[model samples]
Target chain A: MALIRKKIVVKNKQGLHARPAALFVQVANKFDSRITVSNDKEEVNGKSIMGILMLGAEKGTLIVIEADGEDAHSAISELEKIISAEEEK
Target chain B: MIELKGIAAASGISIGPAYKIGKEELVIEREPIKEQDIPIQIQLFEESLIKTRREIIELQKRIGLEMGQEEAEIFDAHLLVLEDRMLIEEVISRLKKEKVNVAYIFSGVLKKYIDVFSKIEDEYLKERIADINDVGKRILRHLLGKEKKSLGDLKEKVIVVAHDLSPSDTAAMHKQLVSAFVTDIGGKTSHTAIMAKSLEIPAVVGVEEATVKIKPSDLLIVDGNKGIVIIDPDEKTLQIYGQEEERLKGIAQRFLSVKDAPAATIDGRTIDIYANIEFPDEVPSVKLHGAMGIGLYRTEFFYMNRKDLPLEEEHYQAYKYVAEEMKPYSVIIRTLDLGGDKFLSQFEIPSEMQPFLGWRAIRFCLARPDIFKLQLRAILRASVHGNLKLMYPMISGIEELEQANRILEEAKEELRNKGIPFNNDIPVGAMIEVPSAAMTADILAKQADFFSIGTNDLIQYSLAVDRVNEKVAYLYEPAHPAVLRLIKNIIDAAHNAHIKVGMCGEMAGEPSFALMLLGLGLDEFSMPPQVIPELKYIIRCVTFKQAQEIAHQALMLSTGREVEEFSHAKLNEVLK
Candidate 1:
């Protein structure tokens, strides 16, 4: 199995702050694959709220995500979709 | 006795032994006992398990009666964990194998499991550890041969000093004995704060390490206004505070006596006074505080404290209750002012560069027509019970007002087609809370049947300051010249269009700004009901002409301090 890891750019103005982080987490939980997020060198469990909060990645920062398990491809696609979608009203 | 001080979370106090929640170290002390004593320890542990399960049910039942069903469920889950055979079997095995007393064994087994749940990152789930430990402590108290702590056990009034307090723990406290609460964690909008505020208890939170210094029976004084907890206050100081507390109680009673009286000037220029309520349960408080009606009935509270969206009937029942209570008085309902600091977890709103400035208030409602229409239909249906006016928040221009009006028209049409009984001529209004909305007041006034100045958001938005951010919080001044001018302009436009304008924000209750608002020609004032009598007194003391002169002087002041100074001097000059 080929494992893909990449840093997705956050484009929203408020950055990966409260609202967006909540969105990111909710989207990440929709998949069955195991996912982890890393900022610079530190990596945390994607499902762990503290890990996502500790990143404190602002707008325009790069976050690397690694996925494994059966739905890695699909999970990555969903996460990317959430990161790029317009702010939900 | 050890002494510690923390931010007051609830008012009324009691003196008792240090009931440290989340702190328990079990001592076996079995060197003097023989191997045959193990059976006694096991039997004691079994009895404690049964006692704890029964106590949990009692606590859950009491809390269910005091707070509600949902908060009671948190304790119910703890009861389930206590009754689990796996935990009981593990503890029984430990007592026999290690020759430890049942008390020590219970703590050891419970601690291991509690640690596992506490390490979880989910805040909601992590909070469950507090509940479990709460249950564990009850059982330990019985096993360790400690007396059951009851609220009635407190001999005198004392402040509760704790590292942290959960809602259930607070709900279990005696209202008469618990004078005030001091906690080491939680913010102004946390569950602790909300509960305290609802109970009208003076509470200060976020004082870290408060539980380390304050001790039981230390004669502490929690000055909630100053956010200061004075440990071991001298007799003289305590006497002074006691007298002051009594005096304030007398004044509060005086205010209550005039709560139902009409809000009118001494010369009889009657002005409408309304309450800003978030829940249907608070409607009685509005009447108790002498509110003629509800001005800003925020519908968000109905949406909050629930897992899913409220069905139309649930919404209808709440709205109808408040509307029926108000009767002939107008109940202005502001539809779901959600977003910004408050976000719904069930759904996600895309992050914006500026949520306050971008897609929020009416903008979000316009985009999600289904959610907006559901609320509209609910409001319309409730209108049949009493006079209820529907208002839109954050209207910046004529386009937004027209879009919202279009929706209201469609909602009305739907109700009419269904033959539902609703007030077809019910007044629809717009909130002049944004600088843009206030600036374009003339255009908005032409479209909106009424205008209400939401001064809290208006000041924050007008100054480009976030009130929650302490660094820029000083910038939040309702008396700022720009804010005053915007208010004046909006009032003028509304009056010119022959439309009634009212205010339902912090400014409505502030005595310093009462004269200025009246001078600007506001038709109504709405605030927390407790403030109505005092504002009415201020209004009755001065005439419209005198208030105009004060308003003119306040507007000329460049800084907030100057405006405040000017308002005080003018009020004293006129009243005296």
Candidate 2:
């Protein structure tokens, strides 16, 4: 088992919200890692759409992503890719 | 005849029998149930929730296929609220503890949520309260064993009289069968009103007791242009309205004959006729009414009724749809003209004492470059699809126009750097709505490619009259000497700068004012698509010389009344 953590700024126009948030959760759920995302104070399960939405992370906000499991690194990177992508899906 | 006054929601004249849409009242009574019956009550509630979910899914699918995916996404919120565990569990808890009927407990829980949601200071949250209420009402209706009434299968042409029409109700209406809409409650910007305008139907909303006084099959006359509804007219009144109706139809018929003809005066001076549209769906009406192009494609609607800001892709798709649909005809997509009277729930703007004069339109956009640049990039990308032009709204002076253009250049540069394909030569225009903008139009025109006089705001701002305020609304006059002078000044400035000027406002749509505007040297007239044909008819009937005389006389007039009287007489004389 491995633990990975990364801090990233939300670069997408709408931040980690709405469709982007759903995409993040979808990517986070693909691995068996325990993934969690947090802003300044609030931490939410990265695999839950509602939890990610409740974070209210708007564009340019600093967020922390953590994943712990065998595939933690890939999960964290894939989830980061979804949030940092500039163009809308 | 009994005349009822209301807000003029849509402009048209419709005379027909009243078709009253009776709203079914849901009767919820608290009946204490036995302990054994509690499980059955809970079962009933669950069944109703399932039923409501199914109905919403069906509506979402239908609206997605018909309107757009964004519009259908409104139901996604509804579905989310419906499946919310907190709300359902609260209702169930109340039913168990209070030992009351499911309907009563559910209503109480729904009301609590509505009250809490409504109290939120955020406008987006406030708007979402409507969705919660809508979903709650659907479940309540099912729990009470009542079916929601629909206006889908209207049998004949009739004037629909209702208390108020919900968005879903208006969406479900048989547009062809309903000749007009007269509602008991709604302002000019209400959902019903916007829907009426989009459907191209006569609508008189905010007429309190319209549903009470009007009966089914009662003869009704809805004068949407004047916001008056006449019910059960006398023979003399009927004769008068009958003649008026025939005259309007005759105008429509006469205009249709010249639909394919160019908008040229008797002396062969050509003037462009265009349509002012709020949605891409209106492009067909623009073509059907013989509009050469869309002069003002208001992009504000893209920012409406949603929590999230519109993505660049959404804006691009909308502009591309209109541009491709119009093909050879140009589509002028105006930037997001939010703030003031048209506040977006997504934008948290502080309430201003005088909103009309407050931070609005281009000022708001300039302050938020991120949002403004997104829209600009979308418009630029879409421009390559057709003859698309972009414009800014409420630009007060040269500085604002320059700043807006600077932002546009930045957006273009970003797209270029990204290797995105866009029309680099897209024409840019600015709206002269503020008195300051109209006064310094020449200086502003030097920076912009063209000018559009938005007379609705111009008249309101110039005269210092809040058009929405019924008491001072009469002071907002388009024919006022000062207004005319400002319009003339704007046109002269634009022309002197070698830029074409157009008017896309209520003043341009007015037939009596057509000669005056033409005489003022307006190169184009853009108005509601429905009025384009009549304006074209007026333009073709009069010569440039005649219009010039009318304009000169109008400028010399002392009062708005005198200008109105003179323009009316001259208009009838020239056209008749």
- Which candidate leads the pack in TM-score? 1
Tens-digit lDDT string for candidate 2 (B1-576): 788999899988888999888875778888999999999999999999999999889887876655545466667667766766556777888888989999999988778666754554443444455566677888999999887788987889989999877666766877789989999976776656767776767899989899989988999989988999999988998888788878877866898788778999999989999998887766766788889999999988887544467889999999999999998988888888887667464665665677678888899999999999999999999988999998899998888988998999999999999999999999999999999999988789778899999999999989988887769977888899999999999999998999999989899999899999998899999898778777888889988998999899899999999999998998889767
Pairs of colliding residues, candidate 2? none
lDDT of 2 at B308: 68
**Candidate 1: lDDT of B258?**
65
- For candidate 2, give the DockQ: 0.04
lDDT of 1: 0.73
Worst 10 residues of 1 chain B by lDDT: B13-22
For model 1, how does the per-residue alpha-carbon lDDT over B26-141 read when each residue is reduced to its tens digit? 45444334589988877887788788787778876876565545456556456555655457777878777887667777787787776755554544444445556677777878
Candidate 2 chain A, which ten residues in sequence have the lowest lDDT sum? Answer: A80-89
TM-score of 1: 0.70
Please identify model 2 stretches exceeding 4 Å from their true place.
A1-89, B1-40, B53-91, B104-141, B144-244, B255-261, B278-289, B300-315, B336-375, B394-419, B434-440, B443-445, B460-474, B572-576
Of the true interface contacts, each candidate retains a share of 0.00, 0.00
RMSD in Å for candidate 2, one decimal? 10.0
Off by over 4 Å in 1: A1-89, B1-106, B109-136, B139-147, B155-170, B178-247, B301-311, B344-349, B468-471, B530-546, B565-576
Which predicted model would earn the best lDDT? 2
